[model samples]
Target: MSRIAVFGAGSWGTAFSIVLADAGNEVTIWGRREAVCADINDHHENRDYLPDVKLPDTVSATHDPVVAVDGADAVIFAVPSQSFRENLVDWAPVLPEVPLVSLMKGVELGSLKRMSEVIAEVTGAGEERIAVVSGPNLSKEIANREPAASVVACADEDVAKRLQAMCHATAFRPYTSVDVLGCELGGAYKNVVALAVGMAVGLGFGDNTTASVITRGLAETARLATRLGADPLTLMGLAGLGDLVATCSSPLSRNRTFGEKLGQGQTTEEIYASTRQVAEGAKSCASLLALAEKNDVDAPIAEHVDAVVAGRSTARDMMQAFIDRDTKAERD
Candidate 1:
């Protein structure tokens, strides 16, 4: 059995810890909140994120980051995209010469760095030793042991293989990729597009509108992914197109659900105040649009989502803007 340490006791972290434990690994999950830690230790539940889901008693919990990483063979950095850096700094002391894999999925603001790049910067880990797990994974579904698949990417083929071994499960299959940037970008950027699609649905737009946005959204994702040195095919895999469809259509996606609130006429302030989950797209939206503009890539759907979230226009106006976009080829 492997010694696995997971940072962040949120749903993804908790669910992943369960996956490892079920695979016969000794898993420890570190959480910042005392309440969350207590819940995991005492009741085997993460009430805040995955309520009513009982966890394995063998899956331990601690409030201290150091305890979590001590002597771990593999580390899963499962913190939210926004807070990953700061949390890694805390893990550096306890982390041995272990391989670090991230479960985060958003580009860093200002830096436009993929989650893998952020891992390299913060941990001084070689690209070969850093990897990421992402796909059309909806955590709640995975927690229920529903069948799922994801892509694990590393520049080094061996590292990708090792990650695939570590993460593969009866219900969760992981594909290997060398295009870390493409996988990361797809996982991150798709959330914004998912938000826009969900908002359109909430605004009473038909399936045709959703299909148009998703298809073009795939194009924009592949364009940026190729520009950033990822294989075009990876975007068509479980991490890219598949995830976008699921998140855009499902209520399980916090970003999509948040956008639905916006489309349903809730103010941004109201939505933010009403929900505690991290809707990563809200933070990533404008910054991604900025990055796309700098790269001279067209991402009108993402830009429209940003406008609605930032209060530059109502959701209805943003839809109108999409309708008024210049006619173009189906492939473009």
Candidate 2:
């Protein structure tokens, strides 16, 4: 059995640890809070984040990063995208020369780098040693062992396949891909689209609006990703369309829920104060918009979402902006 180290004790981290252990891997999680670590060790439950789900017996937790990564066959990072650089910098010295997997799905703010890019820069790991997992993975459903499929991407096909085997469980199926850039871009951009969809929901718009935003958002994602040397077809696959659909449509989605709050006339600061979990889209929208602008891609939805998050535009203003834009060919 593989010894897997997961860094992050949040909902996704805990749920994914279950997947690893169910696949016959011995999983150890590194959590920031000693209470969380103790809960997992003593009860096999992360009551703080995933209180409803029970964890596998083979799964455990530690407060020390060294203990988590020591002798691990692979290390998975499910931390927040914004804090990833700081956290990895501190842990890199203790990390073994094993495959590093990223479960994050947001672009870095200042550097505009994908999580895989951040891993390469921070750990100096070659592309082959770095991987990412993404798709229509909603943590609660996965934690409950509901059937789900995802993509495991690495520059090296062999590495991707290996990881594919490591996390393949009865309820979780993983496909492999060599298009890391496409997978990463797909995962990141979908959150922005989900935010827009959430805004539409909050504004009392129905499926017609949601469908329009979802389709247009996929187009925007493909435009930016392909311009940056990703395969265009990848945008049509699980990472792009599948992820966008799930995140935008599901009520359980944090980004969609955050957008719904904004749509219901709540301020970003108010929402931030209310929720303990980070809504990734709320944080990633600005960086995603900046990345699109840098590449000269016209991403109206992302632009409006970023404006709303920055408090420069209300949800009403965002919907109006879309309606006021000049009519053009749908493909344009």
Candidate 3:
């Protein structure tokens, strides 16, 4: 059996640890808070994140990173995207040379680098050993043992396959892919699109509005992905369209939920105070917009979402802006 270290105790990290343990691997989770770690170790539940979900006996938690990372075959980093670099820097000395799995899905604010890139930069890990786990994974559903499929992407096909085997549970299906760039981009930007769809929902719009945003959002996502040398079809697969649909539709999606609040005239500060969780799109919108500018790609929906989240625009204003934009062909 493999030993896996999950370097965050957030919803996704906790849920994924259960997946690995249920797959017959030994899983250790490192949480920043001692109380959360205590809950996981003593009660087998992460009350702060996945409340009411019981973890497997093979899974454990620790506040010490050294204890969590010791002799692990793989290390999964599931912290917030903005804080990933700092946390990796602190944990780097104790990290073994194993497959670094990124559960983060936002571009670094100023650097505009993907989570894998940040991992390599901070930890000095090679591209072949860096992997990303992403798809339509809403933490609550996965924690309840609901059936879900995800893509494990890495530069090396062998590495991706190995990770796929390590986390392959009956309830959680994983597919391997070599298109790491496509997968990362799809995962990162889809949160922003979900915010847009959420705003539409909060505005009392119907299925027609949601469908339009989803289709057009995928188009914009593809435009940027292809520009970055990613395979266009990868954007059509699990990490892309699959992820976008799930995040946009599910009430469990933090990013979408945050946007819904914005649509209902609540401020970003208000939502932040209430949830006490980082809604990735609210934090990554600026960086995503910067990346689009750097790549000379147009991401109108993402731009509008960013403005709204930043308190520079309102949901109604964003919709009107879309209507007033210059007309173009469907594919264009």
Residue pairs in candidate 1 whose N, alpha carbon or C atoms collide under 3 angstroms: none
Candidate 2 lDDT over residue span 52-85, tens digit each = 6889999999999989998899999999999999
How do the residues 114-192 of candidate 3 rate in per-residue lDDT, one tens digit apiece? 9999988988899999999999999999999999999999999999999999999989999999999999999988999
Worst 10 residues of 3 by lDDT: 315-324
Q: In model 3, which residue pairs have backbone atoms overlapping below 3 Å?
A: none
Which candidate, 1 or 3, has the higher lDDT?
A: 3
TM per candidate comes to 0.97, 0.99, 0.99
lDDT of 1 by residue, 12-52 (tens): 89988877777678888989898999988988889899997
Q: Which residue pairs clash in candidate 2? A: none
Candidate 1 — worst ten consecutive residues by lDDT sum?
85-94
- Judge candidate 1 at residue 257 and give its lDDT: 89
Each model's RMSD to truth, in Å? 1.3, 0.7, 0.7
lDDT for position 50 in model 3: 85
Better by TM-score, candidate 3 or 1: 3
Worst 10 residues of 2 by lDDT: 44-53
Q: By lDDT, who's the top model here?
A: 2
Q: Sort by lDDT, best first: what order? A: 2, 3, 1
